[model samples]
Structure formats: C-alpha cells, structure tokens
Target: MNITTIGFDADDTLWHNERFYVLTQERFADLLADYTDRASLDARLQAAERRNIGHYGYGIKGFVLSMIETAVDVTDARVPAAVIRRILEIGQEMLRHPIELLPDAHKTVAAMAASRHRLVLITKGDLLDQERKLAESGLWEYFDAVEIVSEKSAAVYRRIFNRHGDGPERAMMVGNSMKSDVLPAIEAGAWAVHVPFELVWALESAPAPTGHERYRVLDGLGGLKALVDWIG
Candidate 1:
C-alpha cells in the first residue's frame, strides 16, 4: 500500500538532543565535583527521573531542573552561591543552544515531503522549548502538522491517527526512542523505523522485539531514503 502520512519523533531521532544534555550535565557535575563524584551524580539524576516523572513530566528541561533539585538535596557540603549561579548558567546555556539535526535528516524529510506524503512532526517535551527548537532548526515548514505532547502514550498516537481520518496501516512513524516512537506506533497498528543515537538514556525503555520484521533499525538517517522508497 502507498504511504499517505508519516509521523516523526523529534529530539534524538532527527537531531543531537541527548548529547547536548549529556554535555551540560557533565558540566553541572563538574561544578559539584568537590561534593559529588560522576557516578554518584548520575545516580542522583536518575533518582530525579524516577521522582519527577510523576510531577514534572518529561524532556531535557525537566531533567535539568531535576539535576538542580538533586544538587540541592544530595550535597551536605555547603554549596556556595557561585555554584548555584553556575547551575542556572548551565540551564540557560541549554536553552540557547540551537538544535543540531542528525545527518541526512533534512534531506530525507524534504525527500518525503516532495513525494506528496503528509509529514507530521510528533514530539513530546516542554511546549515552549520544543517550539523554539523547531522554529530555530527551520524544520517547521516541512511538516504538515506539529504536535508537542506531554508523553508518548497509546492515547496520544490514537489521537493523531483519529485526527488524520486515515487508516493506521498507511501511517509511518520514525524516531530513536523505542518506548516513545516504536512500540507505541506498532501497538497503534502503524509501521515504525528506528534510527538509534549513540546513547539511549536509562529512563527511556529499550525496544524488546528486535527481530520483528515490521520494525526496522537503520544504521543512520541516510538509510531512510531506501526505506521510504520501498514503502512508496
């Protein structure tokens, strides 16, 4: 069947998202190096994920705030005012850094758009941050629609599918996160492609059915051309 609509997950799927977070996080850890080790700092950040998922929802910004909370809670050593200023600076830096899309993302997305496929960007994150990134990346124009959701659940996918009024079989989802991009789309009866990044966070679950024929894990975004061509 010819593909009619394509749904894409932003962040690590098309761009270098997690790496920026990782960089800023390491810097944050450096500021607290005297009070906390790298391993311990990572644990504290992980703990914050567990704690804040219920309260703050998801995304890098939320994770950054969690790091701040972790710093405030774990360090018995009197954190100087300078250290707090450093943490806030790191957060501001994260906000200002422009989004860097993965290799071939622009070409592939443009290629699909040229082929008359309705390209929709479905991302979950802080609404304002996600919007800023999309606006800055110059990718917003390529999509027919853009959704910034709180979480990637079955209901979210279902809602997008319902809005399209097209059958799920004709829709395709591409992304790096297995939990957020692949499994949920598959459960919704849509085809999914996985272009994994170098690092997958512990908070995001891994893809379980690695060998499923309907699911694909590409070496990189360049391979997307062949996949989309075949689907066409």
Candidate 2:
C-alpha cells in the first residue's frame, strides 16, 4: 500500500450535494403531480436525465433541462411556461446554495495535507459550477491539484496519476460514487476508498467492490485518517 498520492471526488464526497438534488426533484414531482403520480414522474425524469447525460453531461443545468423535458413529456407539451420558469429557478437556487462540507471533510483533508499526501481533486461536471463549488467549499487550498473533467474513466485516472504523482500503483482515489470514483480508479490500478453518502445520484450508483484487495469502504470521511495510517 505504498500510496504516494490521493485523489478526491467533489460533490457528495466532500460536501452536501445529492440532498439538494433530491429536494429539487421532490418539488418537480409536485409540479407534475397533476399529470402523473410521483413514482411515474420520478421515473420519467430519471429517464430524461439518463438520455441527456451525453448532451448536457452532469450538473444542475442538465438537471433543470431534464426536469423541463420530463414535465413537457408527461404533460404532453402542455406544461405551462411559468412551470418551466420555476424549473429554471430551481436550478439557479441550487447554483446559489451555500457549500456545506460533509462531517470531518475539512479536518480530514487538512490532516492529510499536513501529513504530506499529494492531494488532488478529481471531479466531473460543468467546469464553472464545479469551480464555484470548490471556491466556496474553502477546501481548495489543501489540494495540490484540481481536475474538473467531463467524465471519469480508467484511462483518465491513469493519466492523472501518471502526470500528477508517481503512478497508478502509488495512487489512491477517495469518493462516494462506485461508478465514477472507485471502480475507475481500481481499474486504473490505483487503490480506492469508498465513503458512502446518504443520497447518491442514480446515474452514479453501482455495486460496491466486495473482495477487491485495493478497495476499502468507510462509513464516512472521519475514517480516512485511520485508513491512511493503516496504508502507511
């Protein structure tokens, strides 16, 4: 476990994120309740989100667009313009929301930085929005480097580790998403730690690594110090 560098995912990994999205989705469901049931509306929104990922990628803007699309689809293009405006307002509110760091997120990252770990933030989303969140989170100074990618894949992890640190074998990734954070890092030959969030995006959800030698799941960020110590 000779890890020389560590990568972190943004969004739910370091700060409160999914909860806001869930709240917005609940509002969206209510707005469309006249057209369909909550479950059906949710399903349709998810389908729209999935369909729009390639076009919009992942972020609040994409989400708003998907919600509007879902609203129109469900209502047979009869959704009011005011309702569409409300959906846009929802996305704007999310963009303006305060950054709330997860429990021990700052302390853990600070500790790791103090311990001389080369910390890198590897996140995927709209660059401007991710940049805004990073700046607002106040955890920016701790990271030696920051990567705002359109997506996370094994090749991307491998390239990042190779360029920023020693190599994949000596690198680790920590995040909540098994799909974007852990699996890709593991596939790139790096160690990964899963810090599960209470609410995860459906697109980012995946089964946990069961018996992988280089994978570990922590209940929360507070356990990161112990894991790093054990690795050392």
Candidate 3:
C-alpha cells in the first residue's frame, strides 16, 4: 500500500499498437501469397521476428526487416523490388500512425499525476517511434521520467525503478505484456498491474501470475486510479 512510483508501458498500454503490426502482417501475407501460403508465411515471419529481436530489437524497423527476411526466404530472394518497396511503405505508415489513446488512458494518467505519484513511462521499442507516440499522446507532461528500453527484464526493471523512484519496492509497473511488463517488475520486487490489451503481440505474451501478492489485473485503464488508491 506504499507504492509511489508508477511505471507504464506505452504501446498497447497507453494506445493502440499491435493492430498496426498485425495489419501490416496481413499485408505481408498478401504480398507473399504467390510464393507461399498464409500459414507458412506467418510462421516464417514470426520465426524471423523471434530470431532478429536481439539484432534488431523491438520496433517497426525490425518488423519491416523481418517481413523482408520472410519475403526473401519464401521467394528464395526473388521477391520483386516493388513488393519490398511496399513493405517499406507499410513500415512508414505504421511509424506515421497517429496515437490513439486507450479508453480512460488520458484521465487515468491525469488522475495519477494529480495524486502526486511519480509516473514514469517504461517501454521498449525504437527510440524515435516511442518518443513520437509519447509526444502525440499529449499525456507526456504527466510522467516524471521516461525510459525507452531496448528490452525488458528483471534487471532492467530494477535499474529503472531504482533510478526513477524509491526503487522497485515502492514502484508499480502497469502494462499489457505479462512477459515484458508484469513478470519482470514483480521479479524485481515491484508491484505489477496487468491491463490486457487487444491483439497481444506474440513476443509479449506470458502466463499471468494469478496469485502473486503484488500482481493485480484490471479490465481497463479506467480502474487504475481506484486500484492505486485501494492499494494505498
């Protein structure tokens, strides 16, 4: 009940994210339909994403590269330049995609800030893209600090919470990804709140810690303020 620092994940947590990737993926499948079936193409793309996460990290840039890799693999490196260009365009479109805040995202963040809790954005993705989204969200002023990490892990959570707040013991991480946001934060001894987002990305998926003392789940961001107050 002594939580002070509240950390939030940007994508899908504050706004719509995975939908763009999924839509682009559908587009990728369409482009590769001549060379491979949807199942084969999806599997190849997912494998490419998983393998390339370390090399490319998380973002549309990496996703575009994975699509290109999948295209090349499916077509034996014979995918036309036009298709490649279109894939690049899709990535740009995603990058340019406007920020559309989730239900109650704005109000919840405002309320949290009003309560004088130190809110921080702790998310993973391309630096520029994350920054752009945060800027567009118009909620940037609420956060006392922001962290766009290349990856999320227990150590990363520990370091971020320690630097931004009173350490992980008094920090709370809130996000849709159990893998990236909830689990690691809890492992770092921080309270973690899971707010499930639609179209959960494969890499961010993990089993929920249903009974962890510091773990809580909300059906939506609207419940966040009350949850924090109740915790206090």
Candidate 4:
C-alpha cells in the first residue's frame, strides 16, 4: 500500500532536541551546586511544571524559565542574579542554535518529497519555538502542513488526521516518543513508527502495544527509509 501522506513529530524525531536540554540542565545543576542537590533542583523544576502549566504553557524556553524560577525560589540569593542571567542566555543560545537534523532526517524527507508523498509535521510545543525550529531547520519546505499542538494524545492525533490525513490506513506517524508518537497515532487509526531515543522523559511514557499491525519501533530516523521501503 502506498502511503499518501506521512506525519512526523518534531523535537527528538528529526533532530537533537533533548540533548541540548541535557547540556543546559547540567550547567544548571553545576550552578546551583552550592544551594541544592542536583536531584533536588530537578525535583523543584518538575514541580514548577505543574505550577507553570497554565502560565508559561510548554516547551524548552518555558522549561528554562521554570528552572530559573525554581532556582530563585530555592536560593533566595540575589548574588545568583548573575547565574539567572547566564541561564537565560543559555536558553537564548538553545533557541538560536542551528538545526541538527538526525542522521537521515534530511535525506529521508527529501526522498519522501521526491516520492510526491504529502509530508506533514505534527509537533506539540510552544508555537513560537516550534515555528522557529522548523524555519531554521531547512525542513519547513519539505512539509505540506505543520501542526503545533499542545499535547500528544489520541484526540489530538485524530483531529490532525481528520483535517489532513487520507484516512487511517494511508497516513503514518514517525517519531521518537513511544507515549506520544506511537500509541496515540495507532489509537487514532494511523500507522506509527517509533524511532527510539536514548532518553525518554518520564512524562512521555505509555504502555507498549502487544501486537499491533499498525505499530513499529526502530533504532533511529536512519531506519525510516527501510520502513518506507518495506511498506511500499
């Protein structure tokens, strides 16, 4: 069966997203070493997610802001104002960093474009951040449509499919998050391909399906071409 349209999840799907977060988180840990333990800092930041969900929305920039808030709350030291400034600078750097598409992301997307398949990018994050990443990544041109959603759920996928897909059988979702990318897409009646990443966040965990015809898991985006070949 030929895939009429293909959907992709941003973040860890096509590029090195969380690794940048990891790098900055390490710096944050080291900066707060005097006032708090690394685990403690992480816990506080996690707590801030609940607090800021309504205010800042979601994405890396918001997360870095939460880290700053957490730091200020924990330390209560004006001396660390400089540290806060540095953290903000890091966030800016993260946003501006050039696109680092995963090994075969560009090639795969180009190939798919050549095949005349409708390529849509379905990512959930801060609207500005999502747009900026796509614009800078040289990938925006490859997609026919781009959906920046608030969360990755069955309902969200269904809505996107209804709007853009060729029913369930002909549209496929490819991404790195099992919870978001695979399960929800499969549940929405679209085929799913999981490109496993090394670091899977706790918030993004859902049970793996037992035996689903529409589900697949792979090592990385580099394997996507093979999957396309197999499917085609």
- TM-score of every candidate: 0.93, 0.98, 0.98, 0.90
lDDT of each residue in 1-232, candidate 2, tens digit only: 5788999999999998999999998998888878899989989989999999999998999999999999999999999999999999989999999999999999999999999989999998889999999999999999999999989999999999999999989999999999999999999999999998888788898988789999999999988988988988
Candidate 3 lDDT, 1-232, residue by residue in tens: 4889999999899999988888888888898888999998888899999999999999999999999998999999899999999999999999999999999999999999999999999989899999999999999999999999999999999998889889999999999999999999999999999999868878778898888999999999999988888888
Worst 10 residues of 3 by lDDT: 197-206
User: For all candidates, what are the clash counts?
Assistant: 0, 0, 0, 0
lDDT of 4 by residue, 1-232 (tens): 5777789998888887888877888998888888889998888888887688678766877888788888888887553678888888888888787878888889889888778888889987789888988988898888989998877878887777777767666789999888888998898888899888887766676788858988888877767767877887
Candidate 1 TM-score, true structure as reference: 0.93
Question: Higher TM-score: candidate 1 or 4?
Answer: 1
lDDT-best of 1 and 2: 2
Per-model C-alpha lDDT, please? 0.81, 0.93, 0.92, 0.83
Inter-residue clash pairs, candidate 2: none
lDDT (Cα, tens digit) per residue for candidate 1, span 169-206:
77888998888899988888778898888888887776
Rank by TM-score (best first): 3, 2, 1, 4
Q: What is the lDDT of residue 170 in candidate 1?
A: 76
| Candidate 3 TM-score over all chains jointly | 0.98
For lDDT, candidate 3 versus 4, the one ahead is 3
* Candidate 4: C-alpha lDDT: 0.83
